[model samples]
Target chain A: MDQALPELNNPPKTRRGARTVRKLLDAAQEEFGSKGFHEASVAGITSAAGTAQGTFYIYFASKEELFRTLVFDLGRRLRDFLTENVDETTDRLTAEAQGMEAFIRFVRLYPDLYRIVLEAQFVDPEAFRLYFQDFGAAYRARCEAAATRGEIRVQDADAESWALMGISLFLGLRYGIWEAERDPGPVVASVMDMIANGLKPRPGEGGTA
Target chain B: MDQALPELNNPPKTRRGARTVRKLLDAAQEEFGSKGFHEASVAGITSAAGTAQGTFYIYFASKEELFRTLVFDLGRRLRDFLTENVDETTDRLTAEAQGMEAFIRFVRLYPDLYRIVLEAQFVDPEAFRLYFQDFGAAYRARCEAAATRGEIRVQDADAESWALMGISLFLGLRYGIWEAERDPGPVVASVMDMIANGLKPRPGEGGTA
Candidate 1:
């Protein structure tokens, strides 16, 4: 999360410069998350970042560009974070729970993730599409590989990927953002139980246990 | 979808007045859907409805109120549509599939359903909150009843409700909105396959089928 803005179009030459850009991005997140994209101001972001208003020009052209960059940055960093958590060695079901737990953890750490990401849909539709498209592709690839490896079964990896992504998303909204105080362990277990075995009744398992 | 504005605050007394109100509401949907809430105007709505701008005030006071009314109107209509499709006597799994199909059908019919509902988050936060809260409550109740009736097994009905809702939401976005030309039959079947029997490898069944 503390990483510098290496992906910036105008790369920061000095370490101090990179730090300033990072500060502005972080401040922009808070501003945008709180006031939304239309209402958020560059001056507000700069002031929040503890930098002069002119300093924002050194990093972003306008509030919109800064928002686009922030949206992509969140997507990239979250992908990296989830990828690091669910290693290849774990079984698919285990990885599913682990991935969900990791996602919930990230959502908790970045309390504004939901608002910011959802706002991108209206602010920058392309970025919003790419965010989900990239995630869907990676998720589909994982599902396909798991199917190939005998770790899971699915009718369509593509559709299955969307379903799994939706589950993680809404669960993150509920257990992570809305009820951030709740322990994620039970939520993760319940979801994994449904994904691994489904809601179908098991033999001799009958009514409410 | 062509139902009259019986829920309007100032319900029209005459048949012609009812027609005018319904026209304004439908026109508001298109305007708000295309131009969004802020950019959308009462002028545009009245013009689209082929009525005088003064006619707008005859029913609703402001654009924000119209948007709010539209949001709740869509939700109520959609809920009614789904209720009509998924009857009380069906098995839980069958009902799940039926409900999803009904939802997809509704999404296709009201292509702006996603944008208007989503925009409510930014325009009318309270409305957005109530929309999901009410939907989540109904979904959770259904899950609890299903679990109690031995129609399904779930670790947590509340969490399961959110996950299932997410699946319906994203699937509607994909198959219903984005790929409107494609048949929803396959999407519904595949999702039901996943929900009814999860991704776990079945007994005597392994990799890639």
Candidate 2:
């Protein structure tokens, strides 16, 4: 799979080479995030990175390759961030709430996260699919472990993971990007409430506003 | 607002003109859906409609204009489909379940729905925002109504709406588009269970498999 993906086949062997690659990826994110994939150019990314035009080619074969690499890099970074923030020992519901809050904060810092991922659907369908699939797989594993430990109710981890992912993604889009003014505390609490107690009115509990 | 959108400013005055516009929009869907916005051509849309190239300009000013129009049109059509399919009388939980099931079914039929909507986030940010905003607003209204009637627990409708939308959209992307081989019934039931009962095991209810 790495061989099939030319972008991943070439890896920086030295510290200096890795620094250059990191700079290029950061510049590519800003370039692609602002101007989009179609309007973004190799020259623009190179200039933004303050690297020689030839330096970019040494790291990436083409602009398409760079974009795909950047996408993969972003997903890995995001997963790392989520993993570090969410405690594996916590119950599934607690983990979900913390994970959601962390995701929203991440999106707030990287406002271009959604734009770049969404653009991948058109510019690089395979990357877009892989990004989500990889995230879903990790999420499903965690859910399954939690279920086995009786930290959460027994359920289909596959479906549950996808549904939970949808909740976080949409919430990030709405509160993290679109309406940045709204407090995420209430939003997270409300969602976690539904995730914990559900929307059903408990017996003998009046639905009071 | 319609007047503000140049693409939507021009209205077909006669029944024949309206029919022609509809035909062009339908053809544009196929063209844009298959070829994407940048690669999709005016000639291809017209040809697909079985109409002369000049006739396209009568309805749309340019290919960009037509693409924007098509994105807006698809949103409206999808909103209409969800509205007509989701029974308003049902409680919020039931409505959510039915709506998710219907949306998945809709995507199965119109597999391009996610691609087009996701693409609009990059190609046309305003259209993409409006598409979600419009749906979120309507969803919030229903949620607010359900809360008032004591059918569901009281919560922040705005936040709830976005979360619910995220669930449906992501599920549609996962089950409807990527893993079409899987039955959506199980997916819908799993998600609905989460929404209704949540992940927390009830008191005295052993976490039985």
Q: Write the per-residue lDDT of candidate 2 for residues A42-63, one digit (tens) a residue.
A: 9999999989999888878999
Q: Considering only chain B, what TM-score does candidate 2 achieve?
A: 0.90
Please state the CAPRI-style docking class of candidate 2: medium
- Superposed by TM-score, candidate 1 places the C-alpha of residue A96 at a distance from the truth, in angstroms, of 0.8
Which docking class does model 1 fall in? medium
The fnat of each candidate, in order, is 0.76, 0.73
lDDT per residue (tens digit) for residues B61-160 in model 1: 8898888899998888888888898976888899999998888888888878678998888888888878888999998888889989999988888888
Candidate 1 residue B73 Cα shift, in angstroms, is 0.5
Predicted chain A of model 2: TM-score relative to the true chain A? Answer: 0.91
Model 2 misplacement above 4 A:
A1-7, B1-7
What is candidate 1's CA lDDT for residue A105?
88
Q: Please provide, for model 1 over A81-138, each residue's C-alpha lDDT reduced to its tens digit, 9 standing for 90 to 100.
A: 8889887688888988999999988988886766799878788888898889999998
